[model samples]
Target: MISRGNRGNALEALVAGLRGTPTDRADWQAVIALANRTLLTPDLFSSLARAGQIHQLPEDVREYLRFVHDCNRER
Candidate 1:
């Protein structure tokens, strides 16, 4: 079982892998896993920003969130 304390490091590793060697299928899988876990954390937005992971966010997910944020701001 993956421990909670380790999630941050795992996320870091996954982000690093995605940035440095995105061609690896395993790295992509890790990215997916991290994104899933991020959904449960309120800090995801800030963590992502601090890590500069927003750019690395999967295109569809990032775009969808951006669209939602834009819509909300216009309301």
Candidate 2:
């Protein structure tokens, strides 16, 4: 099983990876969402997504994640 610390480290690494492959907007958006949720800063994901720099997340997984975040925040 993955340790909690490892998961945190992996998410941070993914966030850092964004700076390198910034061309993959979809991936970046997904990564941003993951980072935001994991780090508990949901607005950062939406803010970055709306910024038009990273294209909206296309994958169902990413969309569902955003939906969950939205619903949780609304509650």
Candidate 3:
């Protein structure tokens, strides 16, 4: 149930997360889920890496994002 309003918040959170802002697990989950649904997981991962903020994320989160990016690449 991805509401339109909530998607906006998730997108903002995604941008904030990409900018190296510290978010809770819930926020990360929301943004990641939204990105997954929208097929933007690779773009999100790319943005973080391109901005050199990938290292700011937790190791597990980075691993997950990388996994998604790799899977998408293989698709």
Candidate 4:
């Protein structure tokens, strides 16, 4: 199982990658795969969103974040 710190790092890296001038497909894919392997919680989701960088994320990632946020709310 992935550690919380590592998961957070992956999210941060993904955000950073998305915000870069030229996105890297391999890095994005690796981050997305990491995200898939790690369990996301409300607090982590909130932290990622609070970074104010969601606009830089890909549409699919944004949608996934929204879905996770909604799911967190439902809990």
Candidate 5:
């Protein structure tokens, strides 16, 4: 869960991750949390996929992103 007093920005984490910057699991967690909160998870996932970066992510993360994107597309 994201702490209220956290100094790290979630959007920054997302952008950094998408930029191919080295990010830890914590950073990806934060980005997913924020994207879910903002209802941007599907879009973010699509961006990664379209950019060919989806294959770079861990299998679990890719699965989660695909699940979220599929859910959104079904709506």
Candidate 6:
């Protein structure tokens, strides 16, 4: 399980990556891993969306985020 602290780190890494920061493969992997481990909350989704960061993400990552968002909305 991903601890809250680790999840926060993953979120930060994701945002940084989306912002065009020089993140490595590991950082990107961490974001994907955390996505599988946690649901996308409205606050986080809206934050990314409003910042236009979501559009900056890679296609696969954006798709995964959308999948998570859709799943969360159904719950």
TM-score for each prediction?
0.35, 0.40, 0.72, 0.52, 0.74, 0.54
Arranged by lDDT, best first: 3, 5, 6, 4, 2, 1
Query: What's the CA error at residue 37 for candidate 4, in Å?
Result: 1.8
Q: Which ranges in model 6 have alpha carbons more than 4 Å from their true place?
A: 1-26, 38-44
Q: Return the lDDT, model 2, position 25.
A: 31
Superposing all C-alpha atoms, what RMSD in Å does each candidate have to the true structure? 6.8, 5.6, 3.1, 6.3, 2.8, 5.1
lDDT of 3 by residue, 1-75 (tens): 668877778888786765656355336667889878878778878888887878877788789999999998998
Compose the digit string of candidate 5's lDDT tens values, residues 1-75.
677644266677676555545245435677788878888788777888877777777788779989999998998
Error of 2 at 46 (Å): 1.8
TM-score of 4: 0.52
Total backbone collisions for each predicted model: 0, 0, 0, 0, 0, 0
Index of the highest-lDDT prediction: 3
Please list the residue runs of candidate 4 whose C-alpha ends up more than 4 Å from where it truly belongs after superposition.
1-26, 41-44
Minimal lDDT window, size 10, model 2: 17-26
Candidate 1 Cα outliers beyond 4 Å, as residue runs: 1-51
Global CA lDDT computed for model 5: 0.73
Worst 10 residues of 6 by lDDT: 18-27
Quote the positional error of residue 46 for candidate 3 in Å.
Answer: 0.7
For candidate 1, write residues 1-75 as lDDT tens digits: 455655655676555543443322333344445755665222333445455666765676556545544554576
Tens-place lDDT per residue, model 6, 1-75, is 667876778888756644445244334556767645554333344556667666766677667667767776788
- Whichever of 1 and 6 has more lDDT, that candidate is 6
Global lDDT scores for all candidate models: 0.49, 0.50, 0.77, 0.57, 0.73, 0.60
lDDT of 6: 0.60
